[model samples]
Target: MKAKKIERKVSIALLFSITLLCCGGGQSLLAQANPAVFQIFEKYSKQKKVTLLEVSEELMAEYRIKQFKSIIFEDGTLALPEIRRCIEQDKQDAKKLKEATADGLVVSGYYRLKTVDPAMNRYLIFKVGKKNKVTLLYIEGRLTPEELVELLK
Candidate 1:
């Protein structure tokens, strides 16, 4: 009976360790999977409400790109009608390069804004999550669409 108790206790401990390893490991892997995304958020961490307009040239000229604009929810939710419209427009005009979904969150691929001028071809990426959380990143300049897609992947 003592031997059986020891074996059961060891089994329980092993199961607990595995559970923690799986849960913690997945988050680290996800964070590392796209360090650039995290970096972008960290760069703007001071902003109380980071809207697409806040990053505009009229506001923060340092991060401005004339051809690109972003729309983010202050509450991290994307339930706004304007945001929905913009996303739909992007879906219609931009070419999707890659996307991934886990749990209730979705990270879509970099899209080259086709509706814009060819010389100003901007890249857009979006992260949509549960509870109306959404983040949009707009990038412009010499970065090729392929490079942007790779960064997003």
Candidate 2:
């Protein structure tokens, strides 16, 4: 129960951070990307069997990331479809870095969205692991695609 509360606080802090960063200048930087995907984090972060984590800017400073948010669903039976839809929507305009489909469904994908800031890069990573477990990640930072991939490895 305490852990859940802490997770909620982290989620809220991330939201506040995003709002301050993205909502400046009368437009949101995330508006260029798919905001619906972020909604998934907010909608399910507090639900049972879900874990949401936001990496602190200080830890991410070494990587030059502004924000890093991740969510894992123990059983994504209910959220998978919605996540897929958002990914599909975002894919229409994003650069497809890496993608894999299983049984005619997207099982894993990595995408880079077009942003106004040339130095800043936004990435969305989605993966479905064993037993219907799903993981969704959003990363915003000044790191390039190569650097981000390297960091993941």
Candidate 3:
């Protein structure tokens, strides 16, 4: 009887642990999966000639996006190199969905990050435009890879 009681207790504890992980652990996983690009946003968002847009999931529901964040640097003279380094680091573990290069440098790229939740998809998109302007975008949602491409159009 004592052995049975111990087994039951262990089962309950295990179940409770799994419940907590399913309910509360997803956010931490998402944050952990975010690339180093967030540093760029924090460092440059308040600077002059920088534009930042962060839209909540609730506001982006119509677009099927759970989260949307973008930062644009008009003169990327300083930030471009940092952004490139971050992207290179992020690309190490991500799937390169699309990419463009100019003068042997990555001018634009789209990547799908490995995520814990199959229901949630995460992506990183970056571009370098005229006058060295740079744009970086991060998106999360349930959209398929093909759907994301369509939405970008």
What is the alpha-carbon lDDT of model 1 when measured against the actual structure? Answer: 0.55
Tell me the spans in candidate 3 whose CA falls farther than 4 Å from its real position.
1-32
When sorted by TM-score, best at the front, the candidate numbers are: 3, 2, 1
Tens-place lDDT per residue, model 2, 36-63, is 5888998999999999989967889999
Evaluated with TM-score, which candidate comes out highest? 3
lDDT of candidate 3 over 12-43, digit per residue (tens): 99999998887697765655466788898888
Clash-forming residue pairs, model 2:
none
* Candidate 1: regions farther than 4 A off: 1-74, 78-82, 100-109, 115-119, 129-132, 149-153
- Report how far residue 52 has shifted in candidate 1, in Å: 4.7
How well does candidate 3 score on lDDT at residue 77? Answer: 75
Question: What TM-score do all the candidates reach, one by one?
Answer: 0.43, 0.78, 0.80
The local distance difference test score of each candidate is 0.55, 0.88, 0.88
lDDT of 3 at 61: 86
Backbone clashes, each candidate: 6, 0, 0
lDDT of candidate 2?
0.88
TM-score of 1: 0.43
Report model 2's TM-score to 2 decimal places: 0.78
